[model samples]
Target chain A: MPTVKFTQALKRFFPGLQNMQAGGKTLAAILDEMEGHFPGIRRYLLDEQGRLRKHVNIFIDGALIKDKTHLTDPFNDNSEIYILQALSGG
Target chain B: MKTTLLLGTRKGFIAYEYRHGAWQSANLSFEGQPVSIAYADPRNGTWWAALDHGHWGVKLHRSRDRGRNWQEVAAPAYPEGAEVKDGQPASTRYIWSMAHGGIQYPSRLWAGTDPGGLFVSEDEGNSFELVTSLWDHPSRKEFWMGGGRDLPGIHSIVVDPRNENHVHIGISCAGVFETTDAGKTWNVRNHGLRANFLPDPSTDVGHDPHILVAAPGNPDHLWQQNHCGIFRSVNGARQWEDVGQPGGPAWFGFAIAVADDNPLQAWVAPANSDETRTAINGALCICRTDDGGRSWQEQRHGLPQSNCFDIVYRHALTSSGHGVAFGTTTGNLFFSPDKGEHWQVVNNYLPMIHSVQFAD
Candidate 1:
């Protein structure tokens, strides 16, 4: 299992959001797991095209995920996943 | 008379109520979010805020109790296999315009979006599905492209009051489209519209209609502040006639509001040409035409006439009853109680105003 974390700003949308353990071997699977924890959260992270939203960034064990469009970046069982919204715009 | 001015701005969705003979802020929601459009469904008193989240993408929320509380609804999404162009997946980038179906259908709602897609909801906006007929129109791929936004957007949706099945939508770089059988089939209505930027200024498509508004009294009457100029159509957009003043301030404005009683009467907040979007000659003025675009009277009383750079967006100007109001890029909200004769400041400071609509 991997520990998943999210930006605090996400709590405004998904009030039940919190640090949780998700079982997955890839970033995409982990996001899917997080979506299970907070229904309708996947859209906040990914667009309708299933690509990582332009302003969303996902980190696997403190390193930026390499695959955004495909979401194929793999992770370890003990990896700490951090889903963060990029700070941009006025 | 419409007494509430609903504003969707860069900062949030705000409501300014007209009470005690003066306009004052009444409610505020989505405090720091960019609300692209704030809509009050005339069929029912539901307040909808189309939020353009920089990070989370477009989201929709409706308040049944007039902004006291809100519930997020499913935003329109581009269906699978949909594409802006070959190999380019389509998605709803922005909810630019929204309209209630008509007096006939209480549950029906329509949304026009960026990437040139129209969506409809029938179950009181609980969910929405894309209207594919207009999306599959032949000219869409060949003619539609970015105008004011990075992608072509459907900025206006006008539902015929007589027939909820009939709708006219305005798209930047794509001209006007009318669907008489609801969303079943669409016909291009750009016969006399001129797209100067295109190689053929008189083309049947590839025109930019900044905003399209239909006269409530005459569903056949339509007014558009096009990218090239202002135009009016008397026969349900069958043939548009350019009514823009060649060398006057009424030529290059973004917003136009036609009077409810008289389709001939209208108002426009003029800006400089496409090259310069600021107030004309650094002077903010409102132009009104009472005789069916034959002549326009410029109104500047109680308005800043010097060193002002305010520009009114397409959806920021609205006309209802005897009230006319508009919000500017510089956060100035002006209201005229008796048409365009006089202007008064409702707010001199607010966020970049995106949309304004009056409610009863």
Candidate 2:
């Protein structure tokens, strides 16, 4: 199971998720589990056409995983996942 | 207990003085408005500030005797409809950056604006003349206007001490630009830079470069913080190499600085990227690269961890003879005494600090 966390800024969009834990061995599984639990969380993470949004950030551990379109990075049973809203102001 | 820290807020300008050990603010707006770029010149006993009143264009103000009295200079006019009149002036175009250079030439003043341009004033801040090289650059048409545009339009323009004509400007969507003929002709010396986020990933990775610093001791060498990572150019941007590669932390900050005593010694702030935001190890930390940016080490001793909102603006990170000072977006000013080995908070709870400068 991967521990997925939502940043405080995302609380306004996804009003239901305080915290979530999903069972998965890959990055996509974690996001799928999140969308399954929260009704519209995936839409904010992904575009209408299913591309990663321009300002959303998904991190595995501390360093950024560069597969923007697909969350195919291999995950361990104890991996920590973080979905954060990026700083967008000029 | 007169606090000398000038606070340039989003709404207006305030002068903060440290009385006892706490910080307090005094609104310095002349017409009860906000100031964008402000610098107090002790040499002439005049405080110069650029005001943004939304499409009123950029109006310059001068205060004699340190913010006690003020007078507004005539705002620069556009060439009629050839230039869009931001009727309000407060929102559309803003005076982004200001620098006072020229050792022998009576304290020259330079100001930058949105829509990408530079203006120079010879007689202090009383008047200004637009520098046309960047305004008329070959690729000026393709320059992106808003969102990720805040200081990119001529954000960093530093004149080399050894040679004045050897000037440099940091452009948005483009890499470092240099002019040897005094801004007459230009060259986009972006070799070895990463342009990996555009439709053509190879060519679009170099947009929105933040800080471009030319070491005063060695004008030939320069350091920069780009949208992708940090870079150093040994031959005045003729060639650049990624200095943030050695350190695993991603380089995603708007501020960079080089040691005044040692040109090779540099500092860059690495924040979480738009694609991957991680606060665990990647939130608001300074990376010191002793051997240039070939490698880096994190500098976080007294800084915050959870809401570590330190998004530095252009010219916000500055070095003095004794220490370094940088203002954070969270309205806090931090100073590092031992060359960024440790940090300390000088003042907290300030408005969004757009820029900061030391007085002469």
Candidate 3:
């Protein structure tokens, strides 16, 4: 199991989410698992093309994810993933 | 009747209830989120809040028991690779405004989004589909961003009470558009208006209308608070007539409201133009017109007399019967229970007020 943490910005919309140890091997899998717990969260994190939204960012164990299109970043059993929205808007 | 004032602000949403001549305010919900519009559909007792998350994206929240609890709903999004008639992919930047359908179509809702797009939800506000006919219109390319960051948006949705199929939408720099057969088709209705920013100054489609409203009594009589001036259309939006410049010195403001009983009577808060979008001479006064738009008078009783620089957004001003309400950018909320003759400050400070609506 990998630990997933959502930032305060994302938590504003999904109040039930904070930090959870979800079962997943990749970042995409983790997002799917999170979506299962909280529906409609994936649409905000990813666009209609299944790509990470331009303003959304994902970091696996303090390393920024490189594959935004496929989100193929692997995770270990003790990995910590952080998801956040990048600096945007006035 | 219980008068409820829903204020959408930059930091969240606030609900102020007026009962028996007193006001009660509630703490913020969706705290720190930029709420563009907070609307209560009295037809179904459903309250919809449009949140503009700066970084994440736009979202919609619904509450069944007023603002006690809320649940997230599917926000409008353009389909992947969906392009406009000008070959540009439609995008959803933010939801600026939302309007409920006519009584005949209870479950239907219309949403105006930033980047100049319209969305229709057949299942109330649970889900929405983009109005591609308006999005893919050939004149969409002519629409440009007026004062906001994104492209001009359909910020105003006026649904005719008599006919559910007749709808009118107002875009920032794109002018006014109306459709008789619902969202199946739309036509630009910006005739006899001026766009001072353009080379021609009177282009049909490039005019920026800050707000478009139709009185409940006369749905065919439409009033607009435009970027350049004010206008009125008595013939169902086919043509507009300039009725602003002759009545006031400053014709630049976003908010406009019409009396429920009279279509000829309206209220507008005029701000100084020339890059200073503030109350003229620091005197915040609301202009009222009783004879359609032929003449106007300043109504400043109990309002800020001096040192006021707040600007009202398009949806911030609304009316319910004889009562009129408006919220300013500086978080000042004013209400006039008897039309626009006098005013009372409901709340002085909260966050920058984005919208003010009477949730009866």
- Highest lDDT: give the candidate number: 1
Error of 3 at A4 (Å): 3.7
TM-scores, chain A, per candidate: 0.93, 0.87, 0.93
lDDT of 3 by residue, B195-244 (tens): 89888887878788889999878999999999888999999888899889
Off by over 4 Å in 1: none
Q: List TM-scores for all candidates, in order.
A: 0.99, 0.69, 0.91
lDDT of 2 by residue, B182-247 (tens): 667877777777765666544622455677888766878898887778888889888887877533
Clashing residue pairs, backbone N/CA/C < 3 A, model 1: none
Of the true interface contacts, each candidate retains a share of: 0.72, 0.00, 0.44
* Top candidate when judged by DockQ against the true structure: 1
Residues A1-90, candidate 2, lDDT per residue (tens digit)? 768888886664457777677886677666777888876566557642344555677788866668876667666777788887677544
Scanning candidate 1 chain A in windows of ten residues, the lowest lDDT window is A23-32
Q: What is the DockQ of candidate 1?
A: 0.82
Candidate 3: misplaced stretches above 4 Å?
Answer: A1-3, A8-26, A49-51, A66-80, A87-90, B26-28, B83-90, B142-147
Write one digit per residue (lDDT tens) for candidate 1, span A1-90.
889999999999998899999877777777788888899999988888888998999898889988888899887788888999988997
Second chain TM-score per prediction?
0.99, 0.83, 0.95
